[model samples]
Target chain A: MTSTTVTSDVPALVFVDDLAEGFGAPARPFHGASPFHRADPASTPIDVLDLGITRGDGVFETAGVNHGHPQAIDAHLARMARSAALLDLPAPRIEVWRRAVQEAIEAWGSDGHGAAKLIYTRGIEGTGVPTGWVYVWAEEPEGPIERRDGITVVLLDRGYRSDVAKTSPWLLQGAKTLSYALNQATLREAQRRGADDAVYTSTDGFLLEGPHASLILRFGDEFITPGTDQGILKGTTQGDAFDWLEGQGYGVGARQVRVEEFAAADAAWLVSSVRCAVPITRVDDREMAIDRQVTDGLNAFLLERDC
Target chain B: MTSTTVTSDVPALVFVDDLAEGFGAPARPFHGASPFHRADPASTPIDVLDLGITRGDGVFETAGVNHGHPQAIDAHLARMARSAALLDLPAPRIEVWRRAVQEAIEAWGSDGHGAAKLIYTRGIEGTGVPTGWVYVWAEEPEGPIERRDGITVVLLDRGYRSDVAKTSPWLLQGAKTLSYALNQATLREAQRRGADDAVYTSTDGFLLEGPHASLILRFGDEFITPGTDQGILKGTTQGDAFDWLEGQGYGVGARQVRVEEFAAADAAWLVSSVRCAVPITRVDDREMAIDRQVTDGLNAFLLERDC
Candidate 1:
């Protein structure tokens, strides 16, 4: 069953063929073949033995799609490769995945804002093969409202020290993996604490990233995000935002952020792919002033990102 | 795509209908109907949006099967419920799952040792309904050999304190969730280090469990496993083994173990469902003597378990 015509906001799924046919692997037997093809969303292409679901043994990237272009496509793909390497999975064929993303976006008939979630997994157990898929769908309309109204966030303990990725690489920190049960639990915890979102603080009192977004704080005129050395994912959206902030004559950098520094910050926002840049109006019991001008500009820049 | 016949050692899949129909939920429209049914292993059934695959937002239990009987099923199911509660997933219907396991085992035509893995997920994204499946398959023929000959292990840092479960419940430390990329990575790391398996130690230097198994160290005549307070899963296999040990008039208990005490122990074993109890011949660079009599007796009892 195939449906090329984009209808409602339902997700369009595409499966990648030979997801990790890198250097040592032989070329596909069939020549002139596309690396990916759209599959029926209703069908379950995933096997019961697929480690992707069975073990959550996979890496994924959700890139914001503006019109027909995937935002930070290179960065997202690079991060995916890095995550795969961290998990010791095979290196993903970037060009093939890049083409797959574009094909998925085009097949979804992207006319406005959407998200393309690229998934690469260790595939079926004992197969020595990998699985890849790109699912594209229209973004929810509430993103704009969330950006405008702002969100409340709470600082929660991440239960790991800042140097965890360096000390324990098997812990799989800094990797956007399918093993996100803890991340989802963290989000639910934030909601349970009467907050819309949460910023993770390391066990030793260092500020980290959010469950699904990167934390960016503005102190005076300087913008800063937690350094990537602290076992946090390299934020693609925050990187792009920093570039825009620099262009606007604002000092932007990355460094180790203390948990207590949240009070001294002029403003804060959680930046990521689908949600873009969302201003944090409240941090725990503290209600901070929101920079409406900067927030608006950042959102505009993020939503319209072509690269 | 229906196959009721068990052809080879391939897996037999069964889907549970209304997986989480516990209290405060609607009953099945048809009464006196089976809560689960056999599924075609070759057919695609899982949706791409399943949180099980996307976020690894789910709980699972693997019970060893012998002569069509699921070993430690009750314990496995109970642990699954505990894992679900830890992740805030809906409470699973135990009776339905028990029946599903039986049906799956029957469908698989289990004649010897096998494994029945039960997976209950938070379901497709945005869908309140949960997803569940029972997969039964024949076990590899190497467990007896490994149990008799033994395996080597390396100690890896778990990157968390022993009391993490109580301090940060959102970490989902003790839960048997599908987010096992780290567990898989730990195994790979051990393999890379020229070891057969990996045992985890807390950041504060407390001996923990293995990536997929429980650690049991024999000191003199007393056997000790890591206390459950250390953010580790309560080992169902170890629990049963303890019962057998008690029958043999041996002291078995759980407590906080120090990593440095490994050298002082008489023997150690990494025990799990599928692998049963495999003696640890070496830890890191230290070679330990294997208890062949206890190992063989334990495997025999475990393989012949009726419950």
Candidate 2:
């Protein structure tokens, strides 16, 4: 009954007051005030009838915070905007969100690495107003500093064809919504099968992405990720890594990749905002080789990158 | 923002203390007290990091509360347990939940009608303790007394094959988890297409249920709903209606219904706990006949059902 033990790492929270006022929407009457204000995460600022939780009608982004810098936040914000559009909730005020994230990070005052999560919801039911918040908490990375080695993953069927996004946009396939129960279920399924993570595949035998990350496979010098057209998220971390990879003269592309190509790949990694580039050592029953040099490079670039 | 206008229907909430203690789980150390306690929904009892909102890692059921009676609550609880098992959450204490619902309804003090929504979440992230709450408020039945006419529906591709539940359990298809953003999106798409609601169809041409309701088709004296094997929630209202229909000498069944069969059916109704049985007047551009007699009978049974 008492929550003394569960009260560890309370996040610094900020509620965005002008979340849905973007995209030529009329400004609020009180225009001089700050767009967002910090709130207590433990105080539970959200309404019980908020569509975000009740109907899972919301989108979110989590960016890694290094020292005072929120890493790859612009891309995260852009993706959040895309997700919001996909859900048809409202246009997110990118400037407001950026300031909210900074405020939350500043409130947290963590010089170490942590995760800054931005949550934008469709707001309370029957009310058109949207709710938005950003919470930052310090994340003490367990074990080694770099997360770039030996992650075994199982390929699970996502139960949709690769072209589901194109055929059925209402399915919200490409949108990074808060409705991630199935994604969590996939990871649990992976754990049950004695694997560390899961890589989702289309029913038609095409590699998609991980439950919460983007999958990038290496075929000789060419690095290919399952295209965003395949109803998967456009990974922010993956994008940053691709930029670094391109600069290093490695071919990078996002296209329809077959599951059979996993076996042909020299190495693979599941990339995400918080976790960065985690090397895939095993896929299903097959043992995949780890490209340690490239993995190290990607992780280093991701950890040190300012933007 | 001072939330004054949006604070009209504050539901009476009861938090179940012994939520996940069912299925042979050991009782908590403090056992000599009430299993649940009333809380203010406006206070936001949920943790910001609760998986229910964060990952949509939860299951919920909303039963129609007619006066003091919670309609088909046992069925809803059973379904919630099934959903929790599917999501690997600990089993819910049904008796405790029943009492919590009763407490919430009693606290609401509404004699007319309302919705009693039971929410069982996986609790705050990394905390094993599950969170359970039931909220009840006066529904005040908007407009007419009966909700059994003039509903137009559009058939949208659910983007999964009919046998997805059998082939891919990790998809969490049949389980009524809290991840309903896509379902909300589907409804939006239906509205955009000038329809009131949507009925999902399998990629392989099988009839699935609606986003938030069960589709029941009537062909003369026979009533048929999609089988549970199609990865859809088994409708509690539909089941009660089936029992009532059987007693009325009508044939009722749950089977693998095809999309083509919808056209052949004489009448169709989308049934849910809160809405009862609403007759579908149209499917896409095609107009369908509404069986007023049968619809009225079903609604009467659903609205007046005890226990």
Candidate 3:
């Protein structure tokens, strides 16, 4: 993937050596695909005190860009609204967000495939206002290599019991907040252990979620996913997929997943808007069956569906 | 405290309204109480995409400034360094931070009293560099009065067992990270429930730390804090207070605390660098004992000693 992370050079104050340049230097990132365009990315500044940056007090969603369009825009926005409410943030302006997404989609055209991220932060604290923006970038072509060749997975404890979400509202367990340090750390931890990804098991020992996606298990024809009541962000892509699958007369439902089930499942995969679907062929030393039919069906459905 | 959230006019581009203002704003947050003196708070700019703002991918520390001097500059810096390490961020330059503290303290010049917050974020997401800065502001004169009167607290579930720290490193349980949405939300949850603050209980039922402070229990002359293995951030102020209490020949130690024990203790307080010490006179529906002597001793030690 030509990650915006590496592809677009957003001008920054590199404090290590060029703090002065950060404050006063040249044209950096070539602002890509904008509804609210920063013709000069270098000058699009962020406040030093933005609590979003200072404290990660924010929420975000990513819409997949495939087949020359921003896929699942409505689903992403709806999820963002839910994430906002979970954080007690003001209800987002759906009209405004819709306009931005439309602009983003139009700006990108059908030139390439990537992702568009929508960010909404509680603004600088105390203002009772929020800061919101969109960033769209093309992923490197090799980003989806894993989807074609399944991934190896490991389970890591998410540190909360499976049922902690109902009673502990403050954990914001269902919100997709900007405070992603732990999520990123878990991926690194999995990488360190020679795995491609980590599936979090709640402290109570129930399998929970992947850091950035939802877990799906297939026991023959039944399509099962762990319930959202377990404190994980509801997966928009999974929801979209299940809706389409159920309409086709396939079994789709939510159930508590046990960690050991992955070791024995006939088929499994991680699903998200961006990655679409990454089949789990191996779960911690146990090789599982990968029904190419299930994986292929979901990926094709994910791409063909409209938000 | 006269929160800048409520006091200072920290300028912002209310994107929900003037998205244009966000793109064309002049010098964002009026840099308040400058150490590296921006001269015009209105001109100090933060990049729009700083990961700190984008991801809350950072850590922070607040030094209590009293009688015109920033307290525990060294101790706070040391803790920041550790917080940085926990997040896998680079080790902060202690001397650079020390100079900032010195400059901040020197500039404030015995004015009123409040807190000086030191922030270090992993810069913008794709950029390997990081952003670091300090903000100093005065507290409302009445803010500290709560310390004298004690606070009403409600116990909230922190959603982890006391020992989850050792088993779940990615949780960043002990790190004083900027991902404070949950922390802030817990305090709001407490306030909405008719309480002044919240004390977190580990999922397994052990008493942990407060959202922004450490849990301190007094059993007669015993000065006790919950063990750090419970995944609570080690409080810098609590450490300073414990050192003083021990030097004065009082028994100070770490122990596992239970919820019911609060009702039985001679005194209980939440200690932190900024809040100093807040005695908890009541918890939930249970009224707890608050020993004036113990509360007074700790407060005096807090003000008299430097971190």
Q: Name model 2 segments beyond 4 Å from true.
A: A1-8, A22-32, A141-146, B1-8, B22-32, B142-146
> What is the Å distance of residue A71 in model 1 from its true position?
0.8
DockQ winner between 1 and 3, please give it. Answer: 1
lDDT of each: 0.86, 0.85, 0.71
Write down the RMSD of candidate 3 (Cα, Å): 8.8
Question: Would candidate 3 be rated incorrect, acceptable, medium or high by CAPRI criteria?
Answer: acceptable
Interface DockQ per candidate: 0.49, 0.55, 0.29
lDDT of 3 by residue, A1-307 (tens): 0011222343211110001111111211222222233222343334445567667888888888775566877778888888888888777776556666555555555455677777777765566556566656667655588777888888888988887779888899989998888887788788988999989998667888899999988876788899999999788888987887787788999989888676666788899988888999777778876678767877878866655
What lDDT does candidate 1 reach at residue B166?
92
Error of 2 at B85 (Å): 0.6
* lDDT tens per residue, model 3, B153-213: 9999998878877988888888888888888889989998999999999867789988888
* Candidate 1: tens digits of C-alpha lDDT, residues B13-75: 877875775522232333236666677777755677888999999999999998889999989
Question: Per-prediction TM-score, please?
Answer: 0.95, 0.95, 0.84
Model 3, clash count? Answer: 19
Please report the candidate that would top DockQ against the real structure: 2
* Cα error of candidate 3 at position B72, Å: 1.6
- Measured with C-alpha atoms, the lDDT of residue A102 in candidate 1 is 89
Instruction: Write model 1 residue lDDT over A40-98, tens digit each, in one string.
Output: 67655667778899999999999999879999999999999999999988889998889
